[model samples]
Target: MKFFIIILLFCLPTTLLAAEFKVSGYGSIVGGKVLSGQKDPAGEVEFQVDFYDYAYYDEDWAWDKESKVALQLVASINERLDATIQLVAKAADEWSPDIDWFYLTYKLNDASKIMAGRRMLPMYYFSEYMEVGFAYPWIRPPANLYWWEITQFNGLTYLYNFELGNWDFDFSAFFGKETQTKIKSHDFWRNRGGYYFPPEGVYISGTADVTWSDIMGVNLAAANDWLDIRASYFSTRYTTTSDIMFFDEIDTNGDGIADTVIERRTNPDGTPIRSGQWSLTDFDLSFYGLGGSMYFTYATVLFDYNYVTYDDGYGSRFPTFYISAVYNHDTWQPYVGISQAKLKITRDFDGFGTGEAEEHQIMTLGLRYNVMPGAALKFELNKFKDKGDRSPWYDFSYHNDATLFSVALDFIF
Candidate 1:
């Protein structure tokens, strides 16, 4: 692996292009030991479903582990244009490969650029730097603050980044599509509460029969030494044959018949009557986020406020914030941060979904101790607070709230 990295680095053009070729990568292993409080009727039920790249559990001692590998190739293909290709693969087991990123960039200058293939969306403050492991101050970005939106898009993007005095402005326009065999609900986890699940082959709201479709959006941002700001708007149209599921309708299939109870009728004698309406109504989802960060020698403060709304007319709006302070050393750095996400369902679909809009928070404190020049060990404690209605789990006690203690070794080559 080292030899392969070295050869790839040396063979790429350097002087003529005046561009440099370099290789960088990061990997880490995290283990969690979690404990819970008296079960909260409104907290997470028994969570045993796999989420994204992490594991789930019903027991207090379940540990979550993950590993990843990546490669970045940068070439000064020419003076007016430079190119960068990044590829990453991650796994919890040796058999499967998770392709995280594969994209090519073309730069026109410091003020403008264009990119094609698969790349990160400009949705948040950390979007562009999410994978730059060494640039962040946390063991991992605050999950609560991230909202976990899918980041990669396949298509074309145009961007412009410029600076006026100390203030820097960033703007972008993008278009792309995602294809799947089964369309899954973007809010699949909303109804489930505390537990999160990886979206697989499932028709969303019974509408959008095909698993995927295309998405297009525009974003704008500006940042200075002390403050940062961003805003984005997006729209997606499903290209499936399934019936569209609305808050009041659940025609499970798009066959043009009303299979749900509310839309059905009964005769005067109480005999049931069928209604013909098996199609789901299609709608769009809109998102808006604004936030910034402040830096101090003794501490760094970051905050983000976000809002999400569905076109069907029901949605959630929330604010996620983070603040952390670090005392740097020649070889060891210790830091602590408070992260919180408070979402308000704001509005609901009359009789369709239950539970009032509420807030959820997680407090974490951790340390990073360098074991060597390129390796370090980190330990963190997370406390969770759930305030809302209750739900049942597979078999375990109700999960009102919980705490997790985790430690990991992070390294690079």
Candidate 2:
């Protein structure tokens, strides 16, 4: 099935060349070794299942090889429209033959363009072309800012590029739904019934409902020979799923006074009230941010900061920062950086019952060598520490004093 799709995409009509079509792919083989007494955070964490095992390790401290392969096809049908599709293969066979991107773009004019179908979110770098790691300076993009899971959305986009006086500006707005799949994992909290073992919770279950999401932003940048200044702001939000509750006051056994605690149920009478599973109330969320990058001779420097706060009374705030520099000498690029993340939990959690706040501080250093123009090799090492709550459920105390070493090869054609 995958081979057939690739063949069909390549055979599509295009006027770029009279009788030739384009096909390109790249692969990476990676290994790593590490030493630490802490448990593996990725493996034991109950909330994040797919992100675990991202680090390579041995029985005590060993290295494992991982691979990533990508193929892309582009067909220019006319002067205004072009079609593109990208397929990816990875180390996990269960998730293999993935569709990285597929979209048809129409150029409305020299300054405006519109794209439809499954596309990358235009909100951040390393998102549109993340699999091609060779284009980046780090072995992996900073985990503090880039959680690096599925940042893509299936939707429509409008982009406009223009120049005003001395500054170049580009603005984009997008609306669409995020594609999600059922995650197969064990959750002890959801299996209270003995007859059937069904998954539970929004963070753990795969059958979580879908929601409409949107992203809109603008970028303003100015550059001379020695200095460049750029700044951008992006906002994104997800619609609330049906059956989601804000805060519920429940009264059981026909009692007039409210006695039970529920996050989404409200009671007028004293009967035991259970909220149905399909009430679409308001549970909206949003994030606002500003950041920039700077480039210079021999080395490129970066400093970025962003704050995300929830709209409702839940009171969740995430403040993030990343500062790093890399020097490229045609053959080798060496880099080092420090990143910090603070997750503030204002409303006390009830179900999981962890604590109030969580914080993470990570320091990273790595180097990338250009084996060739289109291919590169990378070696990365990371050390992470958690502050505030030392609970295993919240902090990485499951993986307490954690360290990791990884190597990868990335390419583009």
Candidate 3:
């Protein structure tokens, strides 16, 4: 995997292209800061919008949290086959580059095709182009609705496109899997919450890996001049593993006697000790989603909803949705949005594990000014509200509202 990804770094030259190859790129420079109310346990105000990346903001304005630049290349291998690759440099990673896509597509017919390789998971309406800030009116998508631990997968997809009457239709089925190491969600919830864990002799560590296998999904959609609609379903096997382990002692019998003791460590005062705990979420996961858009001469309205179910009662349901309306005025566009996610805990696992999330909502107000055909300037203000149990966004909880302001320049070349 290291060698394969390293090769992409060399293929990034786009200035000089062949007849069969074309290159294009896009970028977003976004800056944001917390306005009021959100403070950490140390009494310092801070902001963290994306749990998957763990990029953050403080009371002062900052830019590196969400800005990124990406390049894409498409090569025509033959009459029926084409190859593509995309790489991105994210500000949160100190401008380190990461590969977002590398795939090959084979045209089966004029209306059908098949693709194989790594690509973003189409779990939401904007999943395919979510990072292209120029494609959306806001600096970013609603964090509550777009949150997902796994965004990309190594997979194969069969796509068919056809027109029925005055409307065009698209249908696709995909199968793939992905394994992520040293994920952010693991450490984000590391030191939060308290539980009745094993004795203090054993060492506890945070989780490190998230594996999604046997991922299969189908998406169907139709669109006309004024309206478009979509629906999708997906299922996969989920597993999470710990990052570190320390074995202390083993009781050979039910009599609580340590037979083959690995180590004998106890409390500082020679009393019973207490330590942190760790666990994993291993289960079958299912997803259902619905989305639609309405376009008018002066305005556009979009809505998306998604529901996730963890089978075998490993956890409860996760339902998220977003609704936004944008009004267009020549080169100026203004928008407002509302989005939320509901995370529930079930007693099926004896109240042990959850999706490791909270129930929250965000209200958005933003504006976009098209500087030119391929460039835009955006400004947005978001109000974040935690509506339910604040299990752990930080090591502690902040029940009050936190307002954030952001601005961005979205461009393509």
What is the C-alpha RMSD, rounded to one decimal, of candidate 1? 9.9
User: How high is each candidate's TM-score?
Assistant: 0.68, 0.71, 0.82
Candidate 1 lDDT tens digits, 22-44 = 67777666566556544434354
**Residue 193 miss distance in model 3 (angstroms):** 1.6
Expressed as tens digits, the lDDT of each residue in 1-413 for candidate 2 is: 34544554666643445533468876666565554425443443111112312333443422233466778877676778877778877674433687867777899999999987677654444445545677677665566566423366676788787776666666677666563432122222121221121222122212223343555555544554544554555555543232222333456776776577544223457432322243221344454444445667688876666666655344667777777788858899888988777766566545533343567766779988998888888988777665546453433222244566777877777
Off by over 4 Å in 2: 1-20, 40-66, 93-95, 184-282, 347-356, 390-399
Report every candidate's CA lDDT. Answer: 0.55, 0.56, 0.78
Clashing pairs in 3: none
In model 2, the Cα lDDT at residue 299 comes to 85
Backbone clashes in model 2, listed as residue pairs: 32-63, 58-62, 247-263, 248-263, 248-264, 248-265
TM-score of predicted model 2?
0.71
Candidate 2 yields a Cα-based lDDT of 0.56
